[model samples]
Target chain A: MYFLAIGLIYLAVGGDPAGIVALLMASGLGGLIAGFAWHFGRRYGTRVEDLQDSDAPDATGVVGVYPTASLRPIALAFGTTLLVLGVPIGSWMSMIGAAIVASQVLLLVHDTDD
Target chain B: MTTIDRKPSAPTVTLGGDDPNHLVSIDSVIGPSGQEGTGLPTTLVGWLTTTNHKALGVAYFVASLTFLAIGGGLAGIIRAELTSPGQQVVSEQVYNQVFTIHGSVMVFLFAVPFGFGLANYIMPLQIGAPDLAFPRLNAFSFWLYVIGGAVMLFGFAADGGAAPFGWFAYPPLSGASGSPGLGADMWIVAIILTGTSGTLTAVNVIATITMLRTPGMTLFRMPILTWNLLVTAFMVLVVFPVLSGALLMLLADRQFGTKFYVPTDGGSPILWQHLFWFFGHPEVYIVALPFFGVVTEIFPVFARRPVFGYKGLIFATLTIGALSTSVWAHHMFVTGEVVVTFFALTSSLIAIPTGVKVFNWMGSMYGGAITFEAPMKFAIGFLVTFVVGGVTGVMLASPTLDFQLSDSFFVVAHFHYVMGGTVVIALFAGIYFWWPKVTGRMLSERLATWHFWLLMIGFNMTFFFMHLLGREGMPRRVPDYEPISNWELWNQLATAGYVILLISMVPFLIAVVKSLRGPANAGADPWNAYSLEWATTSPPVEHNFEWIPPIRSERPVFDFRWINHDDVGAPGVAEAWMAREGLDDRWLPLAGPVAADVADDANAASSADSDVG
Candidate 1:
């Protein structure tokens, strides 16, 4: 939505607005995809219970125990916000945000439990 | 899982003798003198087709040293040319070729092979494994490297002279109109072949580390050196394929008039930078990070303390590896095409993990009974020099500063500080540390000290002034400069430093000669080290270790001593800590056909794709 607004503003404000809008749109779209992927993975991937049995030390141990659904809305919101902000800066930021989203999804959904 | 007593107290057994540990079967033909020398079977068959990892390691060491000398000579030529500047030394064209080849040889052949020489010779023994996971691929990789190196050097004698393009070979410059010669083509072919060797070697090492550990040895239990190599192998796997692909595409452009990089032909020059840095950024780590591991491994041993924050150091290693890819675009900040904040943030972000490593090393050294042996001296030197290099690296990672320093002597100074100063220094440390094991003898500490001081003084003198040169706005890769450039005096100083560094090699050579000719004095553990490799005799037999024990920790053999003898507080606490992380013994799961199959499949796919195209 923020990306759409940026596009509309670019269209309405003038001076390479199309290029700006296109850049924003591309970046925005990338971020959205990434966020969704992360959300999905977080929802379905490895859970706290899965890691409980292993002795492997992980950074996410603290965050692991939280219920997936409980974390989802917040993650989605955060990712969306990052996606919106990342577009204006350039492709690299959007890609970073996208990676974050993707990794989140991997964390959420790449579970052995099926 | 199996115990065969080829203990230090017993007479040496042939590799393929009646001992159950012997599998390759070359022990029977070892002549009477073989007890004192390489227990190599007296047969052409054994030398050529034998899959002995120890033999392969010897080959790597020999090849690495030969390339080191060649690369050093190339460096001398480059420094000589830059001495006074102007055409007084060599032609501009010839200088271009010389430096290009020099950089290529030093980075690809010298520094890289130096690390691998240690890894190849030591990793399996340290892990309590008999051989690497894919021994044939190890041999194949070594051959391919030699073949590729030879081919690239052959380009020097090509009809148009060697490749005059910079080592990076950025496109448009390397394109048909820019190069118009086969020299560039030879470089492309050679490096692509080399990249393939790297990728294969990486895969083999990774597989070996992951799958072949002795029982009870987990990932966290691996030694710091092995852990570093593990991370480096993964880095190589991720980056080398991209380099291979990029070079292949470049080769296609040159040979078949494809316009992948020719701007007039709609090729993007920036694309080449992207591709090159994709490999190039990680390539720096590929060369330096192992030395970081080398020095890190040595510090604890000499300091007589456990490696501080072993787990944190492991995390830092992995983090550095992952973050390395994201920061490649920092190299492009001068071009202004890169996303500034994105790269800047990532570049600065790397400092966090690097800082962790520095802290860990310092912590390891703190309050410990430190002994500044020759190896210890080099290790300490690594800490100091690498910190300076790392700090400067963080500074350059900023786009704001990078814009001013790119293509300047500052860039050269920065890299040489890390690569030449830190990595090479650490490599010497590793050499000094392991020379007794590899050769069954000890290097002279007196000569080693001489070597160390000269290297330190000469290296700093050569590169320290370059900071000023860059500040004064001198450009790099130029063969000649006018008298008025103000870089003449600094250039002469830097050149003199190179000469000093060259002279420093003499003491090092003398030390090596003294070690080989001196005595067979290094017992199983002359340093009283803790790792599994030291549990075996100096210059380990073909199978390395005889009794394959279930590894309870990273320091398996060291653990045995502690458990059996109740010596938890060893003389060198760090060595004990390293030994405590030893792995259980397992045979490397090397099936030669697997690599052969993969190469075949890849070749088939490429040929099929070509046919379809």
Candidate 2:
């Protein structure tokens, strides 16, 4: 629909009929492919049912530990540090001090319980 | 006496349900038969509210392909103009803008996202995790991409129109006084937003890969795709911000009275170049490495052999990431601000690692039962084209050669070979390889074959002659050329190639539509694959799995086939371990503040341990 709309718009604007035809063909074809890809993807792609039951365990008393949920914040903090370099809160010393404080805060949380 | 090193204490263990120490089993989570699977969600909720790494991967792939088609259409416009190159088509300025947006859209919006999408969807699943550490942030990052990309394009619909300053949006030319339009500003803001998305997503993926692996899924044991993604994520964190910073400054310069680039106001335009390339060079690898990973994934699968020199491949991947950062000045060899020798040396050295990878890929195929599946064909196509591109890159890397070739179509030709020829081919290969996994149905092999041939032929026809044209002193970014130049023949041939390429894409479309309506079914493990992903059904349900199955090797499905053949029933002893091993219910785990918190937690945990000892 988007392609056809664009093609019609092109024609309305006095674009070459042949060019408009070519473009519509390209877009219509691309959209068809994408739609089918999604359809088949939905049908044949991995589904939840194939996996083992979520609540049951084959083994006894085995605990798994993933990273505690604080990793993104540290990364954001680091990003913030870089962003702050663009500003002049202080001289180079201010930048250094801020970096130290951010690093220390990151270090103080989320120890590897896993 | 040296203190004897000891491993850290393992987590607590319990039998069957919610055991913290045991992270592998199928019976505990995601109950059987109509119960919600342990993955993410399978229904609309799974797609809308869920956060599985695999689902995200599929989303990225779909998004990237849409942009690819859009960018390809833009390319068609560019080719049409250059067909005869005499103002027979659009005006010179429109032509310039078309090609510029064409390159920028393809490289930044299309190609860079291509690898990231694949990596996001597949990396965690391949490594036996259920979801990314930062699920919400992942969604946020993707949203940012959509918003940024749209804003950039929307600039076209604006009063001044889309940016025509090329992908780099080089300053002076890009400035308000010079261009005096919102198109460039749109490009600036859009890219800044996009760069932010890239940076955040990189941090998320890196943290997920580093901290969220299942039991025994160590770094070395990870799939090549995951490893490449890891490197890519790291590079994204390092490089994208530089681009973001540059874009912000550029925006300020253009919008406000900021003098970041205005020389009379104590700003140097060359500084903009430095900042841009600082991100630009690595941005190339950022686009390429994931394809390298995809190539790595496809080669062994079709060849029916394990990857050769796995460690070497990993090292080469890492080397490319690190070395890529130092070689940014290679693009600026003619600018004279760069230390020519330093950049030249760094640039030449990058070839060694790239060569190592080529050798390893070939080595992997040696003595193996190689089959020319469509995916493998594309992968092999990448190997051939990328090598040529690499050669050109090496040539351009040289200070003298680059001085000669800089700003010429030669550089354009080289990059198209590398970025367009290689990465785009690999992307097609990845689509073919994972299509069944994503769609639960197979694409028409006949149509796939047609698509491959046309893609290969048309691409070469369009790009190969550009090298010659560029060598003949035709520079890029020009709309019309004098009739006396010999560039006409090559340009004509290239335009014809674009037409052919457009034709080639048609069959794939037909195949997609035909297959979707047909009765083809892709059962789980259609290719007899090795990997946890194959264990699930084709087109996995909402919430990936009904039960979290046990994983021994990286190829859990295959291992399941070889080992105990019994069906691990729902609520079996394995469920607890699987839940522990797999992802949480929600997808975005660490995008918020997980990265910062994890380090601190680790530090606190370590100090407590030391104090105890």
Candidate 3:
């Protein structure tokens, strides 16, 4: 509706048919969104705004899970990057970076806990 | 070091069956936000080891800011060298390295990661999810970027100075024969890491947006900022792979024996251009879309109205995203290998969507109570400069125009207007608008306004004249030029402008320091903003929202305000909204009143059917 409105205004002011056509295309896009929204709502029930006047329900609990952090991935990625960097530098640096990457990747997959 | 497993701490989620009418308390088991995730350390080590999205966001912010400082210093050196007609400040080799690193750091180190910082922090919160879908993947992505960037820049200390080739690092020049040093190799490897990180980040973002949206928050109902990031993330997935492949091919040529880009060995250096710009054009938008999202998110709030044409903005965003992929060849216009008509038209057509956004912003401000605060000022600056930048861009889309302006200061002015003008300035807008939300204190509006004004003056003075210099055929990437052609005057002017731009950062730095020490009194809805992030406290708690506000509409808070509003487009909307919602001071978790409405309609239909029976 907004696009069509703008298109109308553009037509009234100047004979830019291109302007009108572009906006109409945009309006079609707007229609596409509304169409998607309708389908989405029918598929899954619409969640509404929280009204303070309402009462609490029977269920209430939180099981917020924070994944435990591990350094293996970081170590492996960094080591591999260094090994790549080392290829043009020297064989020794390449060997060291490769060893670190190998050990870290093994630790990342094989060693469950860190 | 404490050993820990990646398991949900007993119960993995906070399940709430609160009556669809009441707010569900969301503050149950999610430990304090900004704190480490389950089984992660709370100490500094947690910052390094944790997969929590918020921590990663903060780390990206800090790292990127440091890179900005480095990049900004390099810009100062470049300007200083150009202030006069001679290479007085630094050697030519040093100058080349400085500019190369400046462009690389700004794009790879600062801009992209800056988006990552803001998105990783805010995207999950907007979707009402705890964190990104793959927490470990997010952590690994950040590490890849950091390690890659660090090794790449460490080329400064290598046998030869850093990679002196431009950020593009075009082949033949960048091939083993031309660049025999380790610096170029380091640059190649670093880009690979950055591209890999990009893929990883995009995957996690796409997953979170697709699967983790709060119940009832349909695709259309998601905030425009999230929408922008969604498009940006998808672009990341599509474009990064191409660049990574190209870089690896370049790496293969640079490292083991290969002649992929070697001109003598049945290779064409021009092949690199096709591969690079294919990703490069989208990369420009990748840096841009978030800031566009920022301006969209902020414009409506300060204008004291719902965003003008929400659906229009989303479509425009999508349109820009789609066209961005096809327009890559436009950048190769002067290369003569491009289909001029196809690219020129597509490039010109992009103006329609971009212009639609400009019109939407103008319409938003029409007859509205306008506040010329810091964020708004920067946003206005962005609008003016982006239009100018965009107009010039269209002119260049014409192959004839591009042939003249290619590699000139005009191109520099155009890009800087978009990048420095829109991207960086929009980042400033995000910082100021979200400042109070991030730190529980208001930034001094007085200092913020001063910073905005200086930035405008300094920024324009620096680049606008470059259009003239470019017109005069002043080629780029030169350290010194002959004092003839009156180019010295323009160079001096541009250099002065760069200086002013540099000085403009001081007030902002001061304001940041003062804000940190000032007060902790900014409320959740400082701007009375419409998005979900404002539904929580200034600095959100462990679980972000104590109760996840119901996904009522795209503007949840706005919908909450205008619930009883039968009369739209009235000034008393905010006042009246506060009166109704403020009656009960406690904010419960948001739930649907819509479901009830639907149920009521169904009930009425059933009753009518029964009566007829």
lDDT of candidate 2 over B74-95, digit per residue (tens): 8887777777757776777677
Model 1 lDDT per residue over B372-403, tens place: 88899998888888887887898898777889
Instruction: Give, for candidate 3 chain B, the lowest lDDT window spanning 10 residues.
Output: B3-12
Tens digit per residue, CA lDDT, model 2, A1-114 = 544664565556564333355436535554654575478558777322223332212211112222322333334433443333223223464466466546644653543424
Docking class of 2: incorrect
Error of 2 at A81 (Å): 22
Per-candidate fnat, comma-separated: 0.00, 0.01, 0.20
| Candidate with the greatest DockQ versus the true structure | 3
Tell me how far the alpha carbon of residue A6 in candidate 2 is from the true structure, in angstroms, after superposition.
51
Per-residue lDDT of B489 in model 3: 93
Q: Evaluated on chain B only, what are the TM-scores of all the candidate structures, in order?
A: 0.86, 0.84, 0.86
In candidate 2, stretches whose alpha carbon ends up further than 4 angstroms from where it belongs are: A1-114, B1-55, B546-613
Report every candidate's CA lDDT.
0.67, 0.67, 0.73
Top model number, TM-score: 3
Per-model TM against the reference: 0.75, 0.74, 0.81
